[model samples]
Target: MTAMSLGPAYSRLWTATALSNLGDGIRSAALPLLAASMSTDPVIVAGVAVAGQLPWLLLGLIAGALVDRFDQRRLVVLVDCGRTALLAALTVAVLTGSATVAWIYAIAFACGVGETLRDTATATLLPPLVNDADLERANGRLVNAEVAGNELIGPPVGGYLFGVAMVLPIAINGGTLALAAALIFSLPSVFAPAPTSESKGRIWSETMAGLRWLVRSRRMFTLSLLSGTFAFVDSMWFVVLVLFVQQILELPAAIYGLLVGIGAVGGLIGGFLAARIVRLLGPAPTLTTCLLAAAAGQLMLGLASEVVLAALGLAATSAAFGVWIVVARTQRQRSTPRDLLGRVTSASTTVVMTASPLGALVGGLIGREYGLRAAILLGVPALVIAACLAYAVLRERREPAP
Candidate 1:
């Protein structure tokens, strides 16, 4: 399906998502820099990261249940508006010189709560705007926007703005979110699920209902587990990537930043091309190729001593990740019941959230003891295994839509 065929409602959704993610990326970069400036204590600095992630673990299911129960368009608009308010307060604190490490942590956690709700609601809202056959295309466009805004443009802009004036990035983030809220509020009405007796069940049970459905669907469960593994390995490898660039590759810090930008560019390309690749190779083979490419990329990073080689490795891995995201999300949306989309998406996110920190800790330890290269090398086997599983389980025969 063509992009225009997806309709104007989807365009508004896309614009809102891109704007919100740009704000997210700006805050992500600025917050840590702000934290480190406030306190030299490592624990205090780390607390900001932990606080931002805590909501995903604590509220993912609850947010999903709420999305399933409510009007999704209004839910996302409210969440974004709430986030804008929080950021506006934060911007004021920074400008007034009243901001503390504790203040930053609180706002981070609260904004994270808003993120959980907005993201889950947006995911569930998409199906009504596009046909199932066009999900891959639609999802690819969204992923492209996310990669461009979050990785490519937002961080550099945030870092630059922070250097000029600490309050600038924060204020800009607030403005972007406020605009995003307005855009989301303007989306046309979507198909609301007919209320069933089951829809009125308690939140906990409704959340569990999503898990039960995921567990019963063998294909989805397997795919989600693989996705979790990918998230784990990716997070773990990234923790040591800085050290690898500095120590093994002997590249300057500027080179390291350049490599990250290169990787982000690769992700943009990958997301843009994903739908076409899927059409050419079929979904199973495309996913399998991406996994294998990720494995190869990690191997290259582990072995390379030169900046050129290392950059290539990082870009390859990032591109593979980008493609995998579009393919996986499209499959999930197509296979699941509409009523369960929010919950299933959140359940998958919970797995990723739970795995990432553990992976980061493990990577830090292993890299410190064994070597940075070894830490990256260890991720290769996991990706290879995931690739093998994707090929075996996601074959064309068994993947027909329900």
Candidate 2:
């Protein structure tokens, strides 16, 4: 919330995430809109999203282990460079008049692979860069940059840029990613990841080592499980909301960018306050509140008969998630062993996000079969119940559950 510097290195890392996520916002908005033009079918549009998230399922563990076994700084830089190249290629495809839905899907998946690798390494890098006491605050600042850059400014900019020309946003995305890599390159490598004692085998076996560690930790495992349920529901909400915005709420393309931008404003607020809230309420209550807020937001979105109601609901939902990310990631960072941080973070991310593809598919089906409102309305109770369960789990002072 304050301008208190997080030191020069963290400043660079924070800037990199913020700058890259701005491009992320542009790409996410533009890609879906581009897909919509290529095909009106919700399923095809949904598939692009599925492709984007599929790497978490397919490569999360392998990537995590590789991150742990290699130089984290280089891993992040290489991934950024790869993402930059992929965006450049996508821009060319669009300009040459040869872009297709299939090309979008392929490019999205490739970029996602790069993202998964970068995120694991980045998560591992933080603990070394900052003291334990500052983890939550640092996480908040990082997230604030992400929410503002990606959501608040990026989406709106992307939507307007697309109106100027399809190539406009794509060109900018590539440039931004290149900038991010350069910023990251400015940060020194904290240290090389020390190989695990039993790290003398194939990567899959090495990968499962992290999952096994996660499953063995009752607190981490339970929290991840609870979060996954909401993530699944949230993905469904996301898909249906696009249709809800255009078909039901009747917002046009540019305004859809504004709608996402509004939500990001809420996210920025939440991210700014995450550290203070977590300190005041403690981790359990902070997480419990996030779940309840998310449920309320979803209900508002489902029941809204007007644009303002839906927009407010979306803003609330995004704010809740922004708060949730700060609290949950800090807790994990504090609790996990430093040696296993990359693997554990990756494993948890994989578990929580693994539901998104399914959510995309199911949300599309529910929208097509039952209608968009039904798709959204169906998940409200599940979310609330998950909140209750998360609270109960976090509050348990007794021995950890097996």
Candidate 1: where is the Cα deviation over 4 Å? Answer: 1-5, 199-201, 399-402
Q: Which ten residues in a row have the lowest lDDT in candidate 1?
A: 393-402
The lDDT, on a scale of 0 to 1, for candidate 2 is 0.83
**Measured by TM-score, how close is model 1 to the native structure?**
0.94
Candidate 1, pairs of clashing residues: none
lDDT by residue for model 1 (1-402), tens: 434568888887888889989988888888988999988999988888789879999999788888888888888888888888888898889888999888899989998999888888888878888777778889988888787777888888889999998989999999999888888888777745657679475899999998999888878888888888888898888988888888888878888888888888878778888989999999889989999999999999889988878888998999898899999888888888888899999998788888888889899999999989889999999899899998988874564443
Q: lDDT of each structure?
A: 0.86, 0.83
